[model samples]
Target chain A: MSDVATRLDVLKTYKLYVGGKFPRSESGRVYEVTDAKGEWLANAPLGTRKDTRDAVLAARAAVKGWAGTTAYNRGQVLYRVAEMLQGRREQFAAEVAVSEGIGPKKAAALVDAAIDRWVWYAGWTDKVAQIAGGANPVAGPYFNLSTPEPTGVVGIVAPQAGYGHSLLGLVSVIAPAIATGNTVVVAAAADAPLPALSLGEVLATSDVPGGVVNIISGRTADIAPTLASHQDVNALDLTGAIASDGPGAAPALEAAAADTLKRVVRPELDPFAQDWTNAPGTDRLLSFLETKTVWHPMGI
Target chain B: MSTVAANAPGVAGSGLQDVAASEASLRRFLHGLPGVDQVGLEARAATLGTRSIKTTAKAYAIDLAISMIDLTTLEGADTVGKVRALCAKGRTPDPTDPTTPRVAAICVYPDMVATAKDALRGTDIQVASVATAFPAGRAALPVKLADTADAVAAGADEIDMVIDRGAFLSGRYLDVFNEIVAVKEACKRPDGTSAHLKVIFETGELQTYDNVRRVSWLAMLAGADFIKTSTGKVAVNATPPVTLLMLEAVRDFRAQTGVQVGVKPAGGIKTTKDAMKYLVMVNETLGDDWLTPHWFRFGASSLLNDLLMQRQKLTTGRYSGPDYVTVD
Candidate 1:
């Protein structure tokens, strides 16, 4: 060994990101996170029902400010987020490799795909309105126009099953929601939450304003049910619930969300089916959006 | 002018009346009171705030907090219709739930008192009006007394008057003490009853916990029915330490004179959680005797809505949103 004292590797205390601040769960609970093979990696914050309540509140508060930002500015902000992520690629790849129990090369590839997906959603921000909204033909002296608007605060659950690509799947859900100017309270993949928590750091450093994207990593049952039934949460993406907390989680959450008439993105039919590597279309972006139509009397 | 009625409910009896007989005597008495230890007082308040009150207890606290609110609208732009709406809200609170308790009072400006009084005619809710050229007590003695008289003439049940901070800061203790006495005199009506006088210290401008404690004693000695913290107009209004110091004063004051002066911490208190903290402080400090609407109150407008929302959350398992509440 060398005579020089060895540098102690610094470890990051992963925390839940709410309204742009990294706060440990209010309950001060933490649980051991492990690799796919059950080897302990690190302890992640064990977010509770209160955390979901707080995240939704933060998201709701940001809805007006975030949605009011011009679509062009939102696009620029997402692009900036992607740039921030690109610089942190090596850090995230190492995290994904351990959390997902994958080879380094595969983890690196997934990180690259996640960064590219942000760019893809960045391009969609200004264009989705064009594709989804347009001028309508009306009878007599009136001109009707339609535009797509964000569907307010959306609660998204990242893919949590073992086969799911952690970083790619998380980026796929978050980028689309924020690109449409909808602030999101996301329940990250429980089993492999390190990458997701790291992503919060990336988003915070970028141009994304506070509360635009809140990420929590913990037991899906504890976090997701509250978000589903929260009146402030306008919509919920129940993707992680399909495999997390057993078979009944998704349907139970769907029933709870229906009580508030929330616009829910139901889980995929098969939990172990999709590899999360499929090319993403505008469906994720459009699902969390509402179409607003205006009518103007034609002037002489 | 310094003579106070021994039988007055909140004013410490004739035993303490001789203390304010002159400027020198009042100064000696106020200065004789114990100085506040700021750091310990703030830390104690913070510790009390962390007490987890959940489930049914939270539900009960929410209702109690609602009943303690002096649902207020002191805006210059306040109209009859707005005051009417506030009155309805104060009375019913959550219209969907009949079990929701009505507030302790409806607090408004002097001009809006008659309209509020007319709107809330039969309810037990008192109409408390802020007078004494309120928010700022910069007016002359005649103008301040007239302001108090106007609100009382408009059928106000309680008069919230501001103390002259300039006089208090400049060591003119007797001037401030006598003005509170004059405003107390102005609260009298033709029916031989007087409107409850809530003496506001505007403690944010007072600048020290020691000053807050001093004012609390001075106002109580001057025959104030209630000692209020702030007028809700200044930047740093109604902080926990200041309120705590005032609460300590009232506790000590009541012990010495057998008089229980109410405490109202107004301004900057908006959330149910913050309200709960204040309630916890009160329950722990003064015990159950001061818990009633007769002895304690919150001077707030938005605070009522938050309490209602927390009540709804307890009733319905789902968390509530701002959209579900009234805009006012």
Candidate 2:
């Protein structure tokens, strides 16, 4: 095992992640991750408590730069990811095919849908606030108005098994969250990590900064708790959590995130009745939200 | 806008107009005397195998007198030829049968009346003519009266005139009432016989059930022999709701004045089942008396085949082809 670890270390591209820079794991430990078919793939550094603490610090530090931008500018950046996804879709499909045991054609379709979802949410950023927000007529000497704002750094538990669907689902959640001006820390699809890592590569190449979206791939039980319990996380999207216990995992996630008064998105599964042809509106902007009410005195 | 005084009578006792007023009031009193709404019942014609159905009842009664008009369907024309064939099927009585119902009348347009009159000579069948811009009553009153007179003089047994909805909608109620009474006076039986007047209300143009009920009462009060729905021109001419409202109006009018009124629904009624459903509604709503030809009539272009098809279905266990049924 030590020899194998050594060999894996030789292939490691070690870097520090202080102030949004990737570095070697503080614990100096590496673990071999395999596909569903049990074929050895890349070795990912096993994240430690200190490494998680550093990630939370990076997430907290990067929130203002990510959230302070105007909605239109954010939309333009999100649309840029769509264009990038279009170009790298084949790579995504192949990676997904290996991770989820799906054929190339099906994986390709899923990749296309995921990329389209990015474009869909991209257009929604500037409009959802206007449509869902409106001026109110108050019966007093005050000017009343309401608007939706981002919920800040969101922690997402991406699906474990569906590589392409998980990517689509994660993009669906993340795009809506950040489109309205929120940063995110998503736990990559647990059983399928390569496609997400490839996505990280895309984000690295694209206009998105390092800490805007910080992805970690590890056993969900281990990595998700750090994200759920992290004091700095403003919201947590438990959409991808596997809650076989009884009701759902969202209430528990909500209970945990409540320690910091974080906005919690209860885990949910789509009823799957309507397809894209009938589906209306993007829910991404909904998951990451804060309704801040402001007031000003009117002249008597 | 000048509003007229409510409940005030118009020129009731002016010295110079007293004689004319008395005459008009007397004529109106006599005309308002209620008459039976029955036109003789006409048996619907259907062919069964080598033999034809000559009669299911005695003589078919129609709402329109239709006595003096000519039966012109005998022309070399195609559509007329079809109508002529429909009229002819009524002529072929069985050798052993002598009590077959006579074809009530061949209701035709004014131009075809002379011919229809000629073809139906010496027969009990009366020929009816649809006159006064029949489907749409948008023509001038004088022109309509002239048209009605001409058709009547040309041997039309009945004058089927339509009411002017423009006048009705504008609240010119008296004008519509006076116009129908004047047209009925002009329709004198040509051979000194009193030609019956059947007023066509064109019910589809009136938008509401309240309007239909009011119009039905107004037409009856103004001396109408019948109230028909539509020129068959509009999309909403003959619906069950409209018919139900009209039937109720007719029934109530009869109960009040002992004057049974007739109803004719025209347009878009395509099937025998549809016809039967209408019959069932009328029967249930207006009672067995309304099932007779005097009380009800269907103005349909395609109802015969459906009726025959349904009849065939009842007799035979399985359905047969439509081609086997005789077509007019």
Candidate 3:
């Protein structure tokens, strides 16, 4: 009845991304996400272990087609992601500022860095194979050359700390895994999942195929173990597990990964304290690749 | 229900009573059958597929699934050596583990039946051969019958024949029915012993769930020992919903007539998990009667390796890799 007319803000219901579609967790459970000041942001899907398995299935199904595509086409698809991300820069910066308790200027800078990271990896899609593979000198009369192939589906534990770290860390993990044709099932940052979930939107709008990049927003502990022990997952990144609770956290995941002999990438330093702005090296790009050495007999 | 019995051959002493006296009667009978609610059927299948079979149940299901495989190799490039290797795999899926049960049968093309028969000698494993021009049943009637006769003469225990889908889609139901009866008759050897006749509908070409249901009944009525879902050559092969619908047809057909018909969902079923889902569906839908190898079979080649790997996992108490199992 007051003279002042105030409108209600329409908040988003954050959901998980699987096979290029946004769907609620199959368990139908959600958790409240709050900003730096403990103010209600949104209710994010509390993805269960089953959700992790489903995401892996989708990623595995996508591996053949995504890897079979020409490297030039892959580069074009990745660049499309950067274009989409640039278009949504304002929304991402605002969300990063609220999630990390940072000022607007700092959040904008972080968003710009994350956008530029996608373009950087986009250019590397067609070049990684050439750099990682080459001819080998053999003892016999034969032509031996090693070519890098994708190691199938990869499971990633995205960085789960603050604002800039969440977005930048996600870009760091996903770009390398996919730039070389491997698909990914990522467990997004539990605390600041908004940026990662928004990135799923960008990926879907880009030429990135369905099931190439699946994002699940939930507790890292609840989801990481299933991905670690899954028989079909070819590799796992334990970047977020280093910052997780309990003394046996990272080691237990590594042990589970050993059941499948998955190629495990352990963070070299404390994940939360690392400087994400520094230029990433080829170590991450080489993590999810397998080298196949071809031999041909030298004909007379 | 009584109407199906009146037309079905070898049922109620009808001796191939014509189900479709006229085109109108054929349409009436097909339309009279229950309409399939596609959404509900798919939902039911997906719900059953989510049942988490673990530990003892998973172990048991894996073995049962292995035993039910009609280990198949139907490629144009198949040779005697390939059939021999396939028969060896069927007899002993996992050579390292003697506990592995031999498969139900070894399915091959008609010309390879002699090799499979020779390789499976002195074993209870049956040899199944695809006849009726196999993947495409486009030949003349005489040639199709001769194809079935050759496989049966070569000691095939079962003959899988494809229906002329071109005829079935063009409203010639009677022609389709007569072709199945002809194939069934051709399965008889000179000594009066006959190979079991399995009719393949190739559901992917049938185009609709309602068509699947109609063809299931038609194949059963024409005296099919087993109603198969596909020839494994189409884009959309045996899916869970289609298999579930076929299971319903067999269940209902058996209810009306005293005779029992089997179901085989062939093609695209590769993993142990997928085999388990089909087993779960059979268990819940048709009950325990259809759980045996005689009543249900998976026409697959790669599915056997996955089942063996899972079986090794159960016995070894640890996950087994592909290197541990033989690849034939």
- The lDDT per prediction is 0.89, 0.62, 0.88
Residue B9 deviation, candidate 1, in Å? 5.6
Best by DockQ: 1
Superposed on all Cα atoms, the candidates' RMSDs to the truth, in angstroms, are: 1.7, 29.0, 4.7
**Local accuracy of candidate 1 as per-residue lDDT tens digits, B1-328:** 5545333454444367678778888899899888889889999999998999998889889989999999999898999999999999888888878999999999999999999999999899999999998888889999989989999999999999999999999999888888888888899999899999999999889878888888898888888989999988888898888888888888998888887889999999999999999999999999999999999999999998888888888888888888788988
Off by over 4 Å in 3: A2-6, A64-76, A123-150, A243-248, A291-300, B1-59, B92-101, B164-179, B190-192, B202-222, B234-257, B267-285, B301-328
- Residues A97-150, model 2: lDDT tens digits: 777677989778878888888888888878988876767788888887888887
Q: Return the top candidate by lDDT.
A: 1
* Runs in model 1 lying further than 4 Å from the true structure: A1-6, A162-164, A244-248, B4-14
Two-way DockQ contest, 1 vs 3, winner: 1
> Per-residue lDDT for B1-328 in model 3, tens only?
2344354555655432445555566667776788899999999999999999999999889989998999999998999998998998898889888989999999999999999999999999999999999899999999999999999999999999999999999978878877887888889888887899999999999989999999998888878999999999999899999999999999888877767899999999999999999999999999999999999999998999889877876786444445566676
Q: Local error of candidate 2 at B101, Å?
A: 99
Candidate 2, residue B210: Cα displacement in angstroms equals 99
**How many clashing pairs per prediction, in order?**
0, 25, 0
Docking class of 1: high
Residue B299, candidate 1: alpha-carbon lDDT:
95
Q: Model 1: per-residue lDDT, tens digit, A132-246?
A: 8999998878889999999999999888763435889888888899999999999988888899988999999998999999999888877888898788899999877864444
The TM-scores of all predictions, comma-separated, are 0.97, 0.42, 0.82
